[model samples]
Target chain A: MIENEFYSQQNVGPYEYYQVGEFELEEGGVIPQLQLAYRTYGTLNEQKTNAILVPTWFSGTSKNYESYIGPGRALDENEYFIIVVNQIGNGVSTSPHNSGSPIAMEAFPHIRIGDDVRAQYVLVTEKFGITELALVVGGSMGAQQTYEWAVRYPDMVKRAAPIAGTAKNTVHDFLFTQTLIDAITSDPGFKGGRYTSHTEVADGLGRHADIWAVMGLSTEFYQQELWRLFGVESVEQFTQGFLRPLFQSLDPNSLLTMAWKWQRGDVSRHTDGDLAAALNRITAKVFVMPIDEDMFFPVRDCAREQALIPNSELKVIESRLGHFGLFGAEDSYFEQVDCYLRELLASP
Target chain B: MIENEFYSQQNVGPYEYYQVGEFELEEGGVIPQLQLAYRTYGTLNEQKTNAILVPTWFSGTSKNYESYIGPGRALDENEYFIIVVNQIGNGVSTSPHNSGSPIAMEAFPHIRIGDDVRAQYVLVTEKFGITELALVVGGSMGAQQTYEWAVRYPDMVKRAAPIAGTAKNTVHDFLFTQTLIDAITSDPGFKGGRYTSHTEVADGLGRHADIWAVMGLSTEFYQQELWRLFGVESVEQFTQGFLRPLFQSLDPNSLLTMAWKWQRGDVSRHTDGDLAAALNRITAKVFVMPIDEDMFFPVRDCAREQALIPNSELKVIESRLGHFGLFGAEDSYFEQVDCYLRELLASP
Candidate 1:
């Protein structure tokens, strides 16, 4: 495993790990001795009805949810027990990078969105003896897992919010994800995913950042010169100083593992490719929240699935930040997100 | 210089060359001995008023405009003398790949849209003894040159049509072009633009194709599975069989050269970055044609520039093909383009 301070437990954690031994993957592979890294805010109530499960997104860990958890926020730690679970292959969790010898690096098993939810199920029910979750909320890949949680364990999730992500990955998104994978593997220094350090594949990671600069943010962001908001004078400075270091800090294999799962995030597989049938299984009060400018998961795609769910509402968040708006670059983004999420949680 | 049949004179051409002994660039460089590859259809009349100049776009030769030519079409050979000029660094012309050493490959001087217009100016005024053009039209980078021709020598161009491109390349587009350059240079086999052949950087070329698959085509194109229109069974086949071979056939250094020029295509440079003042200088009757779904040159961007031109109308072409619709992939795309060109040609 390539050691990096960015995702190191010591650097970004006040978290804990839950052991999941010999976990079987959805795609016919075994991740022997699976370990899940998670963080919790507040305490589980005597009825265990106040538990809220928040899954981490691609390249994110449990700590990433800290911004949303505060006294007066929708996910107020004082009112509800918010358990933030890092998705599999997200570095802090048992991933390609830290999985040790035999199943390490490129040899790591291909993960699916279903595999992540199934494992999180064990942590929620077995560890905490929780019978139900007050809410399940997340964005992007975490939103994919949120959809899986609502559909797979319908009765357990009372309220669900899948933000800026579709239940079925679009062919457009799958192709976009492929370019990210191609960017990394094309580097010679990657050494077929056996590189000693992330620095070795700097050029490839830089290319990855370049691709993100085009799609991750909205065109208006560039047109309006919004990078200046980040204190960068030029586009080059924004890309080089900000995006490059952020992605370069990640382990390429870990990213590849998440990307592979992200491309194949199809909840409809449970209902023989029938998306309507899969979404109809949800019993939760669902809010399908998509960012207006999100190229990755356009509002139209999200609305299509939202219409299929029996008890759901399509709540679009306005932002000029595109898919990365989930990072809450503008205060208005989080304000809208919190408003809608609070409404969903307060329902019944 | 890597020799490839894709851009070889005999393979894709029945074109001729014009030698401009020593050409000076707008951006402080010289092409020592510049040669412009051109193809002409029909003959110039005694009045020299039936002449139309068509410039090739990036990665295009004079042949790409063939679909819009011939009998009864807007550019009918019987009605007008049509001259198609391949832009600099597009391989068939004096480019990074074909330019002999001292300034070969990565050593090639940077080219601007103004440099291309100036070189073509010599061919039209000096070689053909033509003081005025009946029409100047093109798409994408060709569109860039069309705008430059109208702005730089306003009186020389009587009618101008720039389709699916902008007067000033957007900051969003500059960053998109960077990803394409980064994809090629990041390849270990590229060897800092010193590769032996095009085949040496196959991975990089493939990554370039991957990026195009995401941005070159519109979202609706992929959402509707339009790749099937190309007779490809899957997205992989469309990308591998169609897009990959299309890009892989060209030399990487040649592409980089065009990409660099493309990113800096700002005719506003003529008026100290005052876009409105630069556009207001145009005396030619102009048709600013932008594809409705074109992500690179969105309708808003084109409309913003068109509103500044004194005698221009913003004509939006509805296409699911996005910017690649300029290739005339569908019959409807060409039908719309022809109808508009016919209108522009018959104007008073």
Candidate 2:
């Protein structure tokens, strides 16, 4: 059986959980308690002026992005109050896989990215009473969530930083996410949502990683040292040796739920009015940073976003370090990012 | 009935029916007349001065690389003579599925990268009747042929340009290719290769495309365009669109043959001594341009190769474009390539 874990510490931050109300998804009328798992780092000032909200990327928890939360990083503990919210479907949050009888495909709710943001909004505003905030920083799917936060509640967020992300589901990300979902939902062991723990889409996940890997690195990276790094001989050893460990780390349920959120990630879709007008309405100071080699979010995407946000600038991370380059590379990326964030904070 | 046609265009160029001799696959015994299907764009001038070998890439043809041959691009037809040779199993050359009887996998001939070069050696020496090649250029699978020519027949190939490709299959490429083969061959519709054209592996092909699309483009590309590209409003529309084309493309016989050939693409396999030592024996001006954003042939892959080759220099094709960028956005790419080829041709 797949194990579901939640964390709550004295001041552990994103590990904190708040029971938001029971919300029903649009597709199936399955009602489940939408308990939000979140974390906060850097204390909120009395005026709540130093708050910066951080949403997650696809298949991510608050934990994955925790490195950027400490002092000297983007969301410095000394400067601003930071909050990292986990979207539903991640094991720490409410997901279909962990529920009782409401787990079948037909029975589970078709939760969208907007729905995820809405749920998180309740946790942020109602429970934490986060009123006027600072920045909404995220990458990949996190970028999607951050965008939603700005568009959904323009008065709340003052700045937006989306890294290695897109405002909408591009054809490439859509296909990859769709394929991954297909891999999980169609897992023979899944028994059409009945099975929870049996190798539910291990091949699919492995395939997903393979597909995802293409955008993560350069051709030079693969040809040169893949076999050597994995310490395997031949293609078979390399494929299995690494993928086996990767498969072990990812839970199938988390993959599926996060995919559902990602597939539905469109801030424009959530808005009733014109997309351009809605985009124009965003008053947040936008800093769109897409890795030069990030396949997930290309420079073209960043260019488009920068064009939309009037008070925005584009920073392309041109390193051989692919998509994950935004996180940390040869320390140069880190230093550049550190400088950029500090300048942004110290600017006005 | 997938309308299978064999085109014989002798009048297009100075052509002759060259019996490709025989191919003894290690999976089985010898098959007579292992014919090669190829085309040449430019004439091989006297003294074989202008000859530049253009080998084929994966899922490519004499037609695919023709764009690079014509004017202004790398291996420009205006300046250098281009020979686009088709590898075995590419329908026209040596193949398994096309073979009348079953060739057992064990005895299938070891058609290594060197073997492909040896076959080209026959095409160049016996058929075209030429010796010194000014340059050997290719991308992806073609790069392997170029590497083989540089190392195996160093005297013939004075310069080499291998782009967006790896020296050998990495775990990623190997798995991707293996998955492609598995999708086609393992389908129940495949019917153990006995079901002649009745059942096609549509799911497999769709799955292959799903896997391939990830490798081909950035996630942003998929996100911004997958729905329209797939021509679907809903998930079902998208699903059917991908599966149909992929399943339809699998000419069972060609797939198996190509898989076999691809598996045997290692150049050092045919060398007398250690592979690295064999590679070091090359005496050519080597230029390996491994794509920086390429997932399959990681930039490091080319770096390792450059380290191995005695006189090799590596150029990273820095672009958000994935593997296909080497072909599509050849703007940033071809200029450097053209200059290199011009310099190579300018040499003694």
Candidate 3:
């Protein structure tokens, strides 16, 4: 076991798990014993029409979405049942660090966005007896899964909002993800992913964080010295104090697994590389939201995909924080996100 | 000795040297017995008024700028004395890999853009008895030096063109440069800058190349599949065949030395960090050219500084190649660059 405290169940907060035995993947492999770690807010209505699915983003857990679910928030736990599911390989779930034996660590099977959606489908239907979802919403890689859900099971999701992500990953993003993978694997301390502790690859993790410092935030964010908003005095302090510790706490193998899947995210594979055909199957009302300054999934890239999907509108969110604006770096971020979600849910 | 053949004198072609013993750097260090490697085309006129100075960019030697100099071209070497100087730490000159002991390899002294400009000034004034330069032009780091020369020796340079570079390095660019530094240093094969051969750090060099694949070229280049022009069918081949070999051939320590200087490139240090005051010192007729899609030094950043120069015009070059367009990847790239140079050189 990697023995990383950050991923331990105790540290990840309270969450329930449903064992999914012998889960076969889209890429020709089996995760012998699979589990979907998740959390639920509020009670299911008698009609079960108010149940919403909220998938976690890259490196995020069910706990990460807790702020969005509250008594009077857009999710509104008092009115709707919100199910926040942890995407596979995100430490809190059945990830490389936690899985034992042949599947543990670097030996973990490759996971696709479709695989995560399919697994969540089983849990949503078989475990809770929920046949339909009021809405399906997520950001970044989680948004990737949201698109997979809309394309794969359109009838089940009444509305979909994919934020700061695209239906198909761009070649540019694929190359960027490769750099992230290279940053981790190049470290000798990685030991071919057999390292017993996360600290062994601290230098690599710091480098990874340094890359994010460049691309994760917008150029304007750095130009305006937005790190001051985080109460950091210098750029070094922001990188070392904020970004480094955040990444170093995670397992390198788990991060690599997510990066691989993130690079290969293409819902069009469901329709033999025909993106228009795959998206046409989606009957759910869709709002394709991309951050204005997001370098990863630029607004133009998202708007192009939005045009292919029927009944879809391009919603451009203003954020100097760029792709990382999904973290609600500014109070305005949540305000805009909540306003959009409320409108999506209220539609016929 | 690293024994990297890519940077050997034989491989870099014939070049002349000017020795300036015990050269002091702007950043509190001395490079003992400093020799500047350079090449000159055409003969100096009796009055020495037709002399043009061209400086090399990061990882570039005097040979890299040959394409821009020829008969009937903008440079018109037959009619002008063109002095192409290899910037320090560019392997051909007094660099980390070639400079033995004392202040060699990892112990090499820090170099500033001002240091390179000062050394080139000495060579032009003392070695050639050239008191005036008709024009000074360069791209990327070469552009940085062009700005430094115009600002530092405003009286000597009559015309200047800085293409695809900034006068002051942005915080965003500083962070991006850090990622490049981290990519090389993170590899265990780096051995704390004591690796005997370049191959020892092949993994790190590959990672460094991977980062370039993401940022060196514009996103439009990838989206439009422009790699096909290079005769490569896939992104992997473009990265592995073209980019990897290009960077892996250089000395890691030399690249590191250049990167550190590149990150801290600021002419404003001459005027206590007042960019406007520094740029106002330029008496030359200046043309500031920025590629349309350059991710590293965006047009807006360049435009802001161009406004600070009293007699400068912003010339936006169209290139799907982005920052690397300075390499003249497309025939049209040379056409626009030549046109601009001709116009600038013809100016009073």
What digit string (tens of lDDT, one per residue) describes model 1 on residues B52-132?
999988788898998889989999999899999999999988998888776798788899899899999999888888889
CA lDDT, every model vs. true structure = 0.90, 0.65, 0.89
True contacts kept of 3: 0.85
Residues A1-348, candidate 2: write the lDDT tens digits.
254332224322338778886786645564466777888787888887888877776666787776676876767888888888887776567766555565533355667777777787787788778887777887778888878878888888888877777776665666666766765554456566555653555655665565445445544445455344435675455456664445435666667777877876776775564556667778887777787866556788668767887777887766555665644535676676666666566554
TM-score of model 1 (CA atoms): 0.97
Q: Per-residue error at A179 for model 1, in Å?
A: 1.0
The DockQ-derived docking category for candidate 2 is acceptable
Q: Write the per-residue lDDT of candidate 3 for residues B1-348, one digit (tens) a residue.
A: 567788766887678899967899988989988999999999999999999999998888888888899999999989899999999998888998888878778889899999999999999999999999999999999999999999999999999999999999999999898888888887778888888888888888888888888888887899899888788999879999999988998899999989998998999988999999999999999999999888889898999999999999999999988888888878888999999999999999
Q: Which stretches of candidate 3 lie over 4 Å from their true place?
A: A8-11
Top-TM-score structure, candidate number: 1
**Deviation in angstroms for B190 in model 1?**
2.0
After the best TM-score superposition of candidate 1, give how far the Cα of residue B25 lies from its true spot, in angstroms.
Answer: 1.9
